[model samples]
Each structure stands twice: as C-alpha cells, then as structure tokens.
Target: MNETVLYEKAGAVARVTMNRPRVHNAQSRVLLEGLDEAFAEAMADHDVRAVVLFGAGPHWSSGHDIGTPEELADRDARPYRPGADGHHQRSWDWNVENTMRWRDLPKPTLAAVHGMCIYGGWMIASAMDLIVAADNAQFLPFLFQYQSTPWDIGARRAKDIMWEQGLLTAEDAHRLGFVSQVCTPADLDEVAMAKAHRIAALNPLLAQMIKRQVNDAQDAMGFRTAIAAGHSAYMIANLGHAFFDAENPFGSRKKMPGIDEARERAERTK
Candidate 1:
C-alpha cells in the first residue's frame, strides 16, 4: 500500500507529513493510523525534541475521507476499531481520545497549515501546541454540524463561524489566537521549521514541563470537561444527520452542496 504519512528527522526536530497529496491529505483509516504510528515514533526517539506536522500538498487537509468504503472496512478490522463500543463511543474514541493522545504528548508539537484546513483538520490543529499558517490558508470549522466549535475558537466566534458557514483567513485565525503565526506561502516551511528548531534547542525536560503546566492549567478550568460535553452533543447531532438529514451526512455526501457551496450561499445572503 502507498504510504499515507512520511517521517523524517532533521537535527532535534521530527517532521511528519501527511502524504496523500492527491486527495489533499484527507484522513482515511490508513492515514489516521499512519499519523498515530508517526507520532509514536517521534515520541520514542530520544534524538527528537520537537515534532512538526504538515501536509505534502497544495492543501493541508480536506478533512476525513468519508467516501472511501474500502478504507473504512480496513480501519474497522484494526485493533482500535473505533466503532467497537457503538457509534457514540466510537465518536469519542476517534474524535476525542485519539486527538487527546497527541495533544498530551510530552514534547511540543507544531502544525504548519496552508490552503484548506477543514473539520477534522481543525480538530488535529487545535490539539497541537501551536499552529503556523501560510498567508493563503483558510480554515473551515465545518464540524459545527457535529457540535464541536466553541472550545477551539472561543464561544461567540464559534457561533458566527457556524451560523454563517464562514471561512477564517490566516490573519483572522491569528487574531483569534488559533494560529500562533502566519507566514507567506513560500516561507511557511522555513518559518515553521525555525520555530520547531528553537523549541528543540530547549532542554527537553524543561520543555515538557512547560507544556504540562499549561495543559494542566487549561484542564483545571474544565477544558476537557467542556470537550466531553461537546462530544455528547455531537453524538446526538450525528444521529440526526444520519437518519433525517441524509443529504448532509457528516458533511461528506456529494448530494449536499458541501462547505464551498454553503460558503457561497452564506455570502450571497450577506
């Protein structure tokens, strides 16, 4: 099978690139597993102090590959069968548990994003320690349909994004504190790698402690609890979509106008 993720070491920094460029690095079962393995590998490597996650394509990610039935079947056969505990539990596992694992990693992680970062893409980026976006990047929080919004970009902004089907420019994301920095498209890699190297140069133990302290502070404020609450609501929303709004099942069906269409419609109304 073709590799869905590529891993490389540069000095103390480990780079993990989502490799399915043809599909804009959409997360299929293999791709998700590949990411898990890549993260694990980076964590295990003593030489690695920081990790950079990005996509090897024009776009960062198109989000989850819901249309790939073969990949879905292959994923179900894997040990982490997300659906093993039923659909709701499965959502928690895939969307919450797995992402949290990466979020709580001991070392710092940076996401270098450009082009389209949608739905699941936003989920992964939000879990990272920092996000560096290319000037041309646009973020779509389409997971609003799944009821996961407020925590990533704050409450009032989330409402606007979801209600209007808005696309956030890199500048807007930076102002909202979702993106740490924004660089020109041509300089994205250089800027992100420089930040990674700077972090890698720090004492790994101290770096980890710093990360833990910040995460702990957030957790103390019920960040995790809020996410869990969102997941519960997400489960209900998903069931409604699956049964009643078949045309827009998880925002993946072609029968639906999709985010691009929704964005246009929202624009016209304005």
Candidate 2:
C-alpha cells in the first residue's frame, strides 16, 4: 500500500499503521481509503485471525483532515470512492458504511491509541472490537460521524461531553467502560499485540460467534438506527448555520476546556 498506510503481519495477527506523522495522521480521504484496503488485506488472509491499528508519530490522530494541502490535492485530483455521489452518499460511505463494515468484520479488531484521540480518531477506534489506549492518551469523543456516543460510553456521559466539551482521560475512559484497558505508552503495543494473539489463538468460529452475539445485542437496542439519525443531523449541520452558540457572540468559538489541563495531567503522571 501507499506510505499513507503500512500493513504488516506478525504470526496470526495483522498490524495496520497510519503513517502520516507530520500531520498527526489526520484522516485524509487517501489515508482513510488506504486504511480500508489494509483492513481488507488482513481479512482476506487466512493466517490473519486478528488485526491491530496503530498510528505513526506522537499522536494517534488529530482528527479528520481540516483542509490540509494534501487532502485538498486529493479531492481535486483523485476519486474518493467509486460512484460515491453527493454529500449524503459520500458521508455515509466513509463515516457510516465503511465504519460499520469494519466493525462487523468476522475477525476481532483492536486499536492501540495514544496521544490525541480526538473526534475522528475516537470514531476509528470505536469501530474496533477492543480499544487499548496509552495511559497518557487524551480523548475528545464527541458526537460526530458515526455518532457512537451512547453505544460507546452511555448517553449521560456523552451529553456531558457536549455540554462541557469535555476531554476524556484514559483513566476516565477505562472507568466509563469505553477503553478496554490502559497501559503506559511504552507498553501499549505489547499489550495490544498480546490481546490480539490471545484472541487469534482462540477457536476462530467461536471468536466470530461471540463478536456477533455482542454486536447483535447492541443492534437490538437500536444502535444502527441511532447512528443513522446522528449522521442525518450531522449532514444538516453541514448544510445550514451550525455550531453557532449564544456564548460565542463574536462569531468565533472560544477555546475548549480540558485541553491544557488534560495534557498537563497526563504528562505529569506519566
């Protein structure tokens, strides 16, 4: 694959690394497309029974590309997805369609996230079956894209994130049952790889069945319906005046809370 994404295999597990350190692995259309190809590669390989996603450089991801030069170039020159027309289809293709496809992959998937796991980063990690974050990771898991707030961390906490623009610490995420485990940055990969191998070693059929069972339970609770509704709202926001708040009377939003505090706390403790 292109340098935007690196794919490798170790025994029974496949590792997919997002490779844009300069931009903190921002989710350019090319990068996301490459990631999907890498995941498909792992799934096609019989020897690969599990997958682990990682990001290159200091941060896992800064979030979706906010008009980066590279991203703009791709939009001008390359096709995002074949036959993906209009805002709705394109948004559904990347944000919902591809996301759920990976989520439903028969093999188990894990994401080892570190640094800034912001909105889009959180969305990517949420697609995986298990998320093992570094203790120093900071999460801004807001209701965006897939709109996985309630399913990932419950409705009340999701509201707290929106109301206060909350930043999520690794400890807080673990306590809220969002992150499956938290480890030091030094041990993050090892811990995630171990989990991948352990799952890979299990009976493959049983593993797939277990995944389906849990996901089915969530779907029964209207997980997919809620996500669809959220996506519709997000598209509407894109169309008209959105993100306007009474507190920001200057036509510009104020700085978010918990950014400095969360970084300092994670740094000092680490």
For residues 1-270, what per-residue lDDT tens digits would candidate 1 score against the true structure? 239999999999999999988877877768877888999999999999999999988889877776666556874575452332465665666668878888899999999999888778888888889999999898877542233357667899997886677788899999988999999999999999999999999999999999999999988988888777777766665666533356544334343234466458547646
Determine the C-alpha RMSD for candidate 1 after optimal superposition of all C-alphas.
3.4
Q: Judged by lDDT against the true structure, how good is candidate 1?
A: 0.80
* Per-residue accuracy of model 2 over 1-270 as CA lDDT, tens digit each: 678999999999999999999888888888889998999899889999999999999999877775678986876695444431464676788778988888899899999999888877888989999999999887876546798977888888898775565578889899998899999999999999999999999999999999999999999989899989998887666443464344542223233323355455445544
Give the least accurate 10-residue stretch of model 1, judged by summed lDDT: 250-259
* Clash counts for all predictions: 0, 0
lDDT of each: 0.80, 0.83
Tell me which residue pairs clash in candidate 1.
none
Q: Give candidate 1 misplaced runs (Cα > 4 Å).
A: 73-85, 144-148, 242-259, 262-266
C-alpha RMSD for every candidate: 3.4, 4.9
lDDT of 2: 0.83
